[model samples]
Target: MSLGNTLSKYFNNRAETSEKHWDKDLQTHYYKTTKDKGLAKLEEIISGSSEYKINSVSTDHGEISFHVVKGKKAFVIGTVIMVRPYQTAIDFTVTTESALPFDFGYSSKLIKKLYERINKDLPLLDKQN
Candidate 1:
């Protein structure tokens, strides 16, 4: 991480995962599972955690909105897309609520942490070997 990116990340209140993010760890992840199964596993992970509270879930839209109740408060939106049968992609958008303009990369770290947990419950499909 360059000083510029580090500074920008710290000074920002949100973090998201997409195919185009410069950070490889921030890239959207694909899993080997059906859309319904993916969403079910994700709901299990989030709802089972005391640190999180699910605000709403739209399985039809493949979207889940939740709030972080542990440590600093934040709002998060998780998306699950079915690119093909048994191939699903997942992404996250997190916005931390803080008195300061930034949460010192809290949002970014949260995405990574959530990804780790999700990967454990689901088979991650890496784009590259």
Candidate 2:
């Protein structure tokens, strides 16, 4: 199965509602979060795959980068952004040519908690919306 499909299945198995199915926005967020939370894993995945090249730099909370592979042909998987604001959360992203997979089944409050853990401050809009 494709990477996207595999992740969709994984999230679906973990979801409790139809509304929680993976979507574009969540996919974007997934890409952003994985890169932020798991760089070494990302690098490991890439390195273990076909020939690849990675370019990265440090950011506020962590690091971000783009991985490219040139083999039978040219292919750009996507970018990664990883963040570890504190001991609380590990945010990351994993973008690809296709949409990444993600779910939004947690309660708004739970999601707020997650945001707060990573961002260090909860936005008022999270409660308003």
Candidate 3:
């Protein structure tokens, strides 16, 4: 193998392996919305983004998974869990696909981008309720 490939393998071996090297990129966001509303908002956000394509959705289980192929490649899986009547939690895992074992923080950036998008619209969603 080439020097770069050898180094990548060595580093990947040392990295966390949960969900196939995506452990560090897994993140959760809490929102003040109902489970149904949270799920709906997630669906709307993913569907509206041309960068993402829906892979599957399980409203019954409060999960929405999608893949984005643009400047940076990633597969995003999210879950909405209700804590109370109007309190909900959203969890996201962003996995970057690359020949190199390290993503150079691309996965984390993806999660932050999603959070920013959702957070920006949260107030409007709350007002409508």
Q: What is the TM-score of each candidate against the true structure?
A: 0.94, 0.28, 0.74
Order the numbered candidates by lDDT, best leading. Answer: 1, 3, 2
What are the clashing pairs of model 3?
Answer: none
lDDT at position 17, candidate 1:
92
Q: Model 1: runs farther than 4 Å from truth?
A: none
Write candidate 3's Cα lDDT for 69-91 as tens digits: 77867778888888777777777
The sequence of per-residue lDDT tens digits that candidate 1 reaches over residues 67-105 is 999899999999999998888999999999988888988
Q: Which stretches of candidate 3 lie over 4 Å from their true place?
A: 1-27, 123-129
Runs in model 2 deviating more than 4 A are 1-37, 57-60, 71-129
Lowest summed lDDT window (length 10), candidate 1? 120-129
- Each model's lDDT: 0.92, 0.34, 0.70
Best by lDDT: 1
- Candidate 2 lDDT over residue span 1-129, tens digit each: 477755554453122112133432232222223333444444554455455555654544344344434422222222333323321222333332323333322222222332344343221112101
| Cα displacement (Å) at residue 18, model 1 | 0.5
Question: Deviation in angstroms for 11 in model 2?
Answer: 28
Cα deviation at 89, candidate 1, in Å, is: 0.5
Evaluated against the true structure, the overall lDDT of model 3 is 0.70
